[model samples]
Each structure stands twice: as structure tokens, then as C-alpha cells.
Target chain A: MMFFEGSEKKVEAVLKPGQASLRQLGRPFWAKMVAQANAEILSSIHNDDCDAYLLSESSLFVWDDRFLMLTCGTTTLVHAVTEFLQHVSQDALAMLTYQRKNEYQAQLQKSSFADDLASLAPHLSGNAWRLGHLDGHHNYIFHLDRPYCPEPNDATGELLMYHIKGEDADYLRSEGQNIEQIRQMMAWQQLLPQFQFDDFLFQPFGYSMNGICGDRYVTMHITPQEDSSYVSFESNLPSEQLTPVLNHLLKVLQPQSYDLISFNMACALSHATGVQAIDHAEQALPIGYQMAFQHFLLPSSQVRSADPL
Target chain B: MMFFEGSEKKVEAVLKPGQASLRQLGRPFWAKMVAQANAEILSSIHNDDCDAYLLSESSLFVWDDRFLMLTCGTTTLVHAVTEFLQHVSQDALAMLTYQRKNEYQAQLQKSSFADDLASLAPHLSGNAWRLGHLDGHHNYIFHLDRPYCPEPNDATGELLMYHIKGEDADYLRSEGQNIEQIRQMMAWQQLLPQFQFDDFLFQPFGYSMNGICGDRYVTMHITPQEDSSYVSFESNLPSEQLTPVLNHLLKVLQPQSYDLISFNMACALSHATGVQAIDHAEQALPIGYQMAFQHFLLPSSQVRSADPL
Candidate 1:
């Protein structure tokens, strides 16, 4: 099978005060905008604080005045962001951050981070920075330069795993895999029992899910082909909760290498036993958010033997 | 300074028996084809075995029956290859190989490897494979699947260094640098004393050189911005000579990480002290070439502290 670009394009926007609640924009409006990105809303879960969407490609989380949307594969996320900007007053945009993780097959993407930045420039003024090495694991981020303050709890953590192994990983690549089996394997209920989940298993392979627990939400997307397997786990849960959740996933997924990223908070991961940090970078963004990134790899002895190509 | 895609696009073609010698194609003909890629031929050097042209972007080498051309930056090398194929009789083609190393900024490229493959499909039948991880250092190769034996001495070695450090790297990035100083720093006379050299020092920063010794040739390209410094050393010299040249380069450049690739031969690099191999991959190409790739990184302690972003 051909390789898929599992690394996502992510856009998060926090609106100005006195602006209309994003919820009032309605599902129909959001779905139409998402369609611009070539993705569909598969399902969604809601709580008092957020509307979490499990999309055909990835996930979207909308709060009262802010939203986080992520899409994978070759989806043109820049189009959706452009559509959203056109539908809203430019004056109402208080802060906007667009992030793209380096992809396995970047050339296949419809737009590069540079293309996206140019498309957004007409709608909003911003500055961009690249974190980490361009030849290795890295992230590109563009954010509005205006003064703004984030909430104390406005923190995000992302755990991106690569080259997964073990029986659980095998099941993910196997034909008999299903949503329920994956749920049990992940043990999300035991780990985050309060969260409600909406998930989908793609035909042949791959899986995606959205989980909401009060204002905090978590999402996971998996592409489990033997050659280029990848899993991404993201959450807005408190920093303390990030460690256990990340540890559990690492234990289950058993990836050879992984990256931990935190926004507006310090990453709480004290490297797990066999894992070693390869590179670490921290930057205080001009837009008032503190970003930290660390890439980790398992010791050679701990890594599972890969099948010959 | 903005980052340039130092990684290169390479194309090699072997002609069928009874075909006219490529040298007979003349400089004007080859220059026209290189122009199709938006690159200019800056200078050239020749010996009994080959004609090596140093282009504004990279290098080109032509032998009687075969040619190897490489171009970097955003140049559309596929276009140049297409132009060359059109000039020659299709019936004269025996085998063709196209390769692309993963770039630091792939999204900036005019065409992806996949796009190049599609463009060449009508002119040549070939199979392709990716060596190494997509998220890190990797190479995409497309080759005609036909039986052809390479001479035992028909081998090539590439040493691609990233995040270069030390005084020489600093000189390369500084304004006071010159071509003669670079040549002395590289000590080509001591290393490959028999080879004749043609070199260029780009304004402000960077360097490129072509060295020819009889039938063998060596080329080096340097991009030395502090954040994204890279140096590429390639040669058709015997395998035994490869280790010393590569070792001398690593000692002088002191890159944080690097990749060593060998075609039709084994990579003879024994791990130097403090350096560790992160990954190694080997494959026998359908076109009768043995390809081996290894990625290595210096211990964290040995790496120079990078300037903060």
C-alpha cells in the first residue's frame, strides 16, 4: 500500500470579547467550511464547554470563543481556514495560530506551510517560526502578533508516535481490528473514564477518535501500515494528567520514537525508563504562548526488530 | 538568512550499445537542457573519463555512455531530464535512474519525486523505492528494471552533513571567506592531490567545487547558515578512498548528524569515536545496483551548543 501523510495541519483561533459565540454558527456552517478542506464531519460529541468533532480525516474542537481544527492526509486545511476567516469579521480575530508538523510525505500535500501563510496573510497579520531541525522532527507555527492573554488552563499537549510495535500494533494493522477492540486496547475508559468518545475505523486500516470530558478534550488518530505507522494523541487536559495519559499510550503503542509538545505549559514527561530525549527546544512565542518540544527515541535494545523491506 | 533546500535531485542514464557518445552532444546542447531546470552552467572541468560541469545549483558529470546530473535549490530537474530525453533517441536508452534526497524544505520544491516519476513514465519504464524513514533523512529512487552489470569499480559514495560546527563552518558563513581559503581549508591537494579542481564561493556564504582525477570525480557543495548548515561530499573514487575523505570532512566540519550512502558498493565507514549509527538500510535495486544507507549522530556532549532561536 502507498504511504499516507498522517502528520496533521492544525489551526486554532481565539476570538475577541463581545463576539458572537462560535456555537451559534451551527453545525451546518462548520460542516460547509470543513468541506472546503475536503473533509467531512463523521460524528461529534458535546459537553458544557466544547463541541468535539471526529472528522473523516481528523478532529475539530470548538469552544465558546475559540476553536481547534486538525486535518490529515492531503486535505487542504488552508482552504477551510480561509473560508472561516472570510465568514467572520477580521476585527473579531483576537489570536490565531496555525501549526504543521513535518510530514512523512510532504511533497504529496496540496499546500506547504509557506503556501498556507501566504493565504492567511490577507486575512490576518502574523509572524511565523520553525521549531527543531528541518531535516528531522520539527514544527512550523504561525501566530498573530497582537497582545493577548491565555487562560491559566489554556494548555495543550501532543504526543506523536512513530514506528509502533508489539501485538497491539499488529492488531491495528490486521483485518479483524475494530473500534471497540482498539478502545479496549487503548484503555481510554480506565485512563480518562469521565470523557465521552466518538470514533471511526477506516476501511482496510487506520482509526480516529474524539473524546470530550467537560471543557477538556482528547483526540487520537492512527495510521498503522507496517512501513510508515504513526499515531498522534492530543489533549487540552491539565499538565499533571498529561504524564499518565502519555505514559499509558507509550506502554501500549511501544513506538520506537516519539515527540512530546506542549503549548502554554511545560511538558511534564520525565522521560520514561528506556526512552531518551534526542532534542529539546523551547520558545516563548511573541503571541503570548510558551511552546516546548522534545523528541525521544527508545534504546536500540528496547526497539523491536523491523521487518525487511 | 532564509533556508535553501540543500538536498539535491539526481538523474543518471546508461545508453544502449552502438549509441553515439554523449560527449558528441556538445556543451551548447547540454547547457540548453540544464537551462530547462532554471540553472546556469558556471564552469566545467574535464579529464579522460568524464566532463564535469559545475552548475549554479549543483554539478553535472558526463561520460561516453552515461551521465550523472544533480541540481539543488528549487530547480525543476525533472524538466531538464525531460529535455535531455527528447534530444536523444528513445531507442538509445538502456537504463535510467532518478533519485531525490529528502529536503529540509520540501514544500518549497517545484515538483515532488512522485510528480517527477509521473512526468518520466511515458519515456521510461522503472520501479521506485524509498530508503530510510520519511520523517527523517531518506532517499527516493526510481530506476529502469533491466539487466545490466556495473563494472566492479562502478561505485559512488555520498556524505551529507547537517548542522555543521567549528571554525571552518564559521568561516564559510562569514563575509571574509574566499574560494582559495576554502580550498586550503579543505586541503584537496593533500587529500586528492592528483585531481584538478574547479570551485566557486557564493556571495556572503556557501561554496561549491568539482574535482577530477583521471576517470574519477569528486564534488562538494556547502550551505553554511548557522541554523541550517549543510555540506554534501560526493565521489566516484574507489571505496577504500572513501573512508579517509569522509573522516577528514567529519573532523573538519563536525556536523551534528550526517548520512552516508553508497551505490553498487558497501559503505566502509567504521563508527568514529563518539559517533553512533541511528539507522542502516540496504537494498538490491532491480537495475543491478547495491544501495546502502546509514544515518549517524554525534553524542549530545560532542555537539556544539546551537544559538537560541
Candidate 2:
């Protein structure tokens, strides 16, 4: 199978009080914007507080005054954000944050984070930071330089797992796997019973899902190739709910290593068993958010031994 | 500066007896083949046993019976090897080996190792093996399936250093650096006084050198960017000479990690100070070569701490 880049480029933006409701921009407009990134909107679901899109590459979410867009593969996501900025003036934005997980095949990407920063410079000013080693798993963040207050409930947690193992992982890689079986494998019902879910199983392989519960949401994207398996789980739920959700996914996927990221929230996976934190860093973003990142790996004793020559 | 892929694609082939000596093929023929890979022949050096050409990307060594070619960047090296194979019948090759180091930017390349293997399959039957994890530093090898015997002294050692540090590395990256300064910095005069050296210092930054002493040869390539610094030292010298050379380079480069690769020779870096082997693998190739690979990294305490976020 050809390699597919599963890591995502993500953007989170909050509109000013007097701005037009983002939901009112309509799906067609958002579809055009997504197309600018070389991705398509497969389908979308809506709740009273949000609109969650299931994209051909990843997912996008829209609320009255804020939205989040994430796309994977070789999508030029910066172009999509720039297109959106052309429609909405910078004065209409209260806060903006863009993030990119270091890619498995970064050279395939149409633009680097630095390139994206240059493209976005015309519309808004921002500060960027790289959070980990360039030789290993890392992340890049670009946020508007403006400062502001955050809602007590404004929090996000993301868990990115790599080199997954076990029968479940094999099943995901196997042919004839379906969405219902994957949902059952993930056990989202037990993990987030309050949310309503929508998911898609791609031809041959891959999976994506979006769940919405009033204002809070959880989304997942899975690429299960044996050579470079990866699964990412993200949620806006409080830490108590998010931590268990992350731990549950880790138990089922059983990755060799994983990274936990929290925005305006505390990371609590230090108590997880079997894995040790290999790297950790935290930053108080200028845009009124506390960002913490921690990478965990199975201890050498627990990790699979190297194959004998 | 834009990121350049520092990893190399390498090819080694042994021609049949009574065939024209590879050196007799002349610089023009080899230049055409190198041009097929989009690299230019800068200059060349010769000794009794080999003809070494310094290419814009890396190096090439041609002997009467065999030739070794290496090139980095986004060059389509498989094309060059394929071009050479077109002129030399498969029956004119007793043995052949193709190798590729895991690239820092794989997707930028014109073809993956698998693609190269497919292209080569038409020219010769071969067995391919991966020597390490796909998610980290690894190598891919494709060797013709044929019984062979090695010369008593048929040995090679290669040292690949990553994330180099110290004032020497900074000097290599800085503007206005010259070939003489680099030669002194690398200390080849002390390290291999017998060998005659020809080196190049790339504009902006980078270095490549080829040294020849009778039949044995040593070559070096340096990509000294701060974010993704790398230096590689390779030689066909015996283990005793090769081991000390590697240790001296390690001491001068002060890299965070490095890989020692030995062919028909034992790897002897287990006692290197400050670093420990994180991965090791070995294999007996069908073509009468024993290959061993070891990856070493500084202990956590010695590696520079993470940047404060």
C-alpha cells in the first residue's frame, strides 16, 4: 500500500462578539474552503452547539463564534485558512491558534509550518514555537500574539499514538473491516455515552469519526497500516472524562509510544501504567492558553525486543 | 535555509571477468550516468586501485572489477544505477548490492526504496531486507541472489552521525567557511596522513571530501544545519584503522547519536564513552558478506536538555 500521511494540520479560531456566526457561513462555503486544501467534506453532523464535519482527510467543527479545522494527507491546509481569512477580516477574530504534528512524511507536504506562517502573515500576526526534538516526534504551534481571557471550560486534550500493536490493530489493518466493528473495538459508548457519533470506513483501509454531545466533542482518525500505524483521539471534554478516554484507547490500540497534549488544561496521564514519560514540556501561550505536552513510551522491558538478524 | 535530505542512496556492483574495467569507461560515461541522477561531477581523484569522483551530492568510486556510487538530496539515484545497468549486461555482473539510508525527508525523493527495487528487478533478481524500524533510523538493502566469495581484506566501515554539536559544527554551518578550514577541522592530516584528499565546501553551508590511498578509500559528507545536522564517514580500511578513525570523528563531531555499519567486519564501538547502543542488528547476506549495524545515543544526562517552552 502507498504511504499516507496521517498527521494533521489544525486551526482553532474564536470570533469577536460582534462577528457573524460561523455556522451561518453555510456548508457550501466551508466545502469550497476545504477544497482549497485538496480535501473534500464527506458528511457533517450538527448539534445545538456545534457542526462537526467528517472530511475525506480528517474533520472540521463549527460553532456560533468559533471553529476548528483539521486535515491530513498532502493537503495544503494553510491555503484553506488563508482563504477563510479572505472572507473574514482579522478584526473579526478574537483568538487564533494553528498547530501541526510533525509528519511521518513531511517532505511530501506542499508547505512547511514556516511557509504557512509566511502565508498567514498578511492577515494576522502570530508567534510560533517548536515543542520537541526535530529528530523525533514533535509539534509546531502558531498562535496570534494578542492576549485575552479564557473561559473556565475552554480546554482540549489530544492523544496521538504511534506504532500500534495487538489483534485489534491487526483487525483494523485487515480487509473487510467495517465502521460498526471499529466503533465497538474503540468502545466509545462506554467511554463517552452522552455523545452521538458518525464515522466512515475508507475503501481498503483507514477510519475517521466525529462525536458531539451538546457543546463538547470528541473526534478520532485512524491509519492502521502495519508499517506506520497511528491513531489520534481528541476531545474538548474536561480532564476527568478525557483522561479515561485516552487511557481506554491506549489499552485497546497498544502503541509503542504516544504523546498527550493539553490546551488550557492539565495533563494527567503520569499515573498510567506500563509507559514512562520520555519527554515533557509546557508553554503559557501568549493567547491566554496553557499548553502542555508529554510523550510516553513502553519501558524497554515491556517493549518488543528487536528482531534477530 | 530549506531542509536538504542528507541521507544517501548507495550502489555497489562487481563486474564479470574479461569485462572492460569500470575505470576504462572514462569520466564522460560516468558523468552521463551521474547526470541521470541529476547530480554534476565536480572533480575527481585517482590512485592505482580506484577512481573517485566528487559529485555535487556525494561521491563515486570506480575500480577495475567493481564500482560504488553514492548520492544524497532528492536525486533519483536508482535511475543512474539503472542507466549503468542498461549498458552492462546482467551477465556482466557477478554481484550487486543497493542500499538506502532512512531519509530525513523521504517523501521529497523521486522514488522509495521499494520503487527502486521494482525498477532493479528487471535487471537482476535480488533479495531485499530492512535492517531496522520503519519509524526511526533504518536501512534498506537489495542484493543480487548469487553465491560469492569475499577477498581476505574485503571490509568496509561506515559512521553516520546525527545532530552534531560543538564549535566545529557551528563553524561548518557558518558563512565564509572554506575547504582548507574544513580539512583542518576534520583533522584528516592527523587521521589519515597517507591519503591524498580532495574536498568541497558548498556555498551557504555543507561539505564533501574524498580521500584515496592506494586501493583503500575514505569519503566524508557533512550537512551541518543546526536543526538537522549530520556527518557521515565511510572507508574501506581494515577494522583496526577504521575503528580509531570512527572514534576520532565521534569525539570531534560530538553528535547526540550515531550509527556504526560494518560489512564483512565487526563493529567495535561498544566501549565508546558517553554513548550507549540503543539498537543493534546483524545479517549474513546471501552474497558472502556479514553486515552489522549499531545505533548509539548519548545517555539522557549527557544530551542537552529540552528547550524551555
The ten-residue window of minimal lDDT in model 1 chain A covers A300-309
| lDDT per model vs. reference | 0.83, 0.82
Worst 10 residues of 2 chain A by lDDT: A300-309
Q: How would you encode candidate 2's per-residue C-alpha lDDT over B27-103 as one tens digit per residue?
A: 99999999999999999999899899999968999999999988887888899989998888888898888988877
Q: Give the candidate number with the greatest DockQ.
A: 1
User: Would candidate 2 be rated incorrect, acceptable, medium or high by CAPRI criteria?
Assistant: incorrect
Cα lDDT, model 1, residue A184: 95
Off by over 4 Å in 1: A268-274, A299-309, B16-18, B90-94, B270-274, B299-309
Residue-by-residue lDDT tens digits, candidate 1, A1-309 = 557768688999999999999988999999998899999999888889899988986888999999999988899898999999888877898899998888766677787888888898998888887776666787778888788888889999999999898999999999977789899999988989888999999988899989998888899999898788889999988878877888888888998788888888666564557666677767888677888777777644421221232
